[model samples]
Target: MNKLIFLLFFAVTSCTTFSRYSPHNKMESCVEGYYCIVNDSLHLKYETLGGFYFANNLKEYRKIKVKNKPKFKNIIFYGKSNILDTDYYLILNNEIYPKNFYFKETVINNKKITIALNSNTNGTYNKDFILNFRLPK
Candidate 1:
């Protein structure tokens, strides 16, 4: 009887953590070198430092950790530039979506990294976003 009650409680709590509005499980499931921001029904993930850089979404909001987020930003093809190792410059681009509903470049401060991004998500909803995160030197 005691075991059954414990199991029931565990299951209920587990399901609650996966909810989109769940805040407790937000930082609880992040890996050592990654950070995540929960938006509406999307989980945008960023890495502190790694081989690849950029935040992306390809799955429903969940607490499970994926090895790497997809390549959402391409600074080389879109801007005709090179990406550096110290920082990341990204622009969200898509034509299928209407204006003001896709992705855009948020101003990145040079407190942590020193790179450039020639963002061109103009006339879209990409300019209304901003992300600020600092890594320890």
Candidate 2:
């Protein structure tokens, strides 16, 4: 009985299996700025190169993990990219999200854009956040 209880305790204590998301500014061998993303806090360093473009498995909230329960996911995405250039473009449609959260290039255009998210991560939501600005005409 003691051995069984020990095993159960180990399993419960090791249940930090939640997803993570973090974005940083980086350049892809070019002078232009690009978003460097990291997913899964438990991922090995070898698997973090080039970063990810779309990460929709982030755990926005904290919760206890129970046996056989659904996994926690996190979400963090980089800016848009152009085929001809490595620089990423992002129209800050949501001022709530920090403009310096990651690398993003602003264009002189006026069209509004949005990125829709469809995920099953618990407590994780893709809300409508808009950030609109324009350059000198």
Candidate 3:
């Protein structure tokens, strides 16, 4: 009985007391200031190379393991790419989601853009949050 109780306690604490995002960034060869997560609080690190894009459309790819339940305001994404003023799609779980899917606001300046993530308004906490952007030509 004591052993079972200890195991249950360990499971519950492990899940609740820690973040779901990974602490390690996996994209080792990303072009500097191009495809990466900028915020420090989100604690998201790519577990895989995520995905690749065609030469025509340079997609930013990231497959981060969900280590913690993210705070709505803390989820910020800063990106720099060629398609600045064009529409962008956030591809999650092999589906196309809007840029504002989990965004509270987005500010674009030149080739840089900052996206502030919102609460669970449009997306949910899953095993992994895939960052695959579909930018227009």
Clashing residue pairs for model 3: 19-67, 19-68, 20-66, 20-67, 20-68, 21-66, 21-67, 21-68
lDDT per residue for candidate 1 within 10-39, as digits (tens), equals 996554212222232222224564443322
What's the TM-score of each model vs. the native? 0.19, 0.23, 0.25
Question: What's the TM for model 3?
Answer: 0.25
Most lDDT-accurate candidate = 1
- The candidates, ranked best first by TM-score, are 3, 2, 1
Which digits, one per residue and each the tens of the lDDT, describe model 2 over residues 1-137?
Answer: 99999999999876532222234322232112322222233221111113224322223212221233322122223222122222122322433333323322332234222222222212211112112222111
Comparison by TM-score, 2 against 3, better one: 3
Which parts of model 3 have CA positions greater than 4 angstroms off?
14-25, 29-32, 36-116, 119-137
Clash counts per candidate, in order, are 2, 13, 8
**What residue pairs are clashing in model 1?**
100-125, 104-126
Candidate order by lDDT, decreasing, is 1, 3, 2
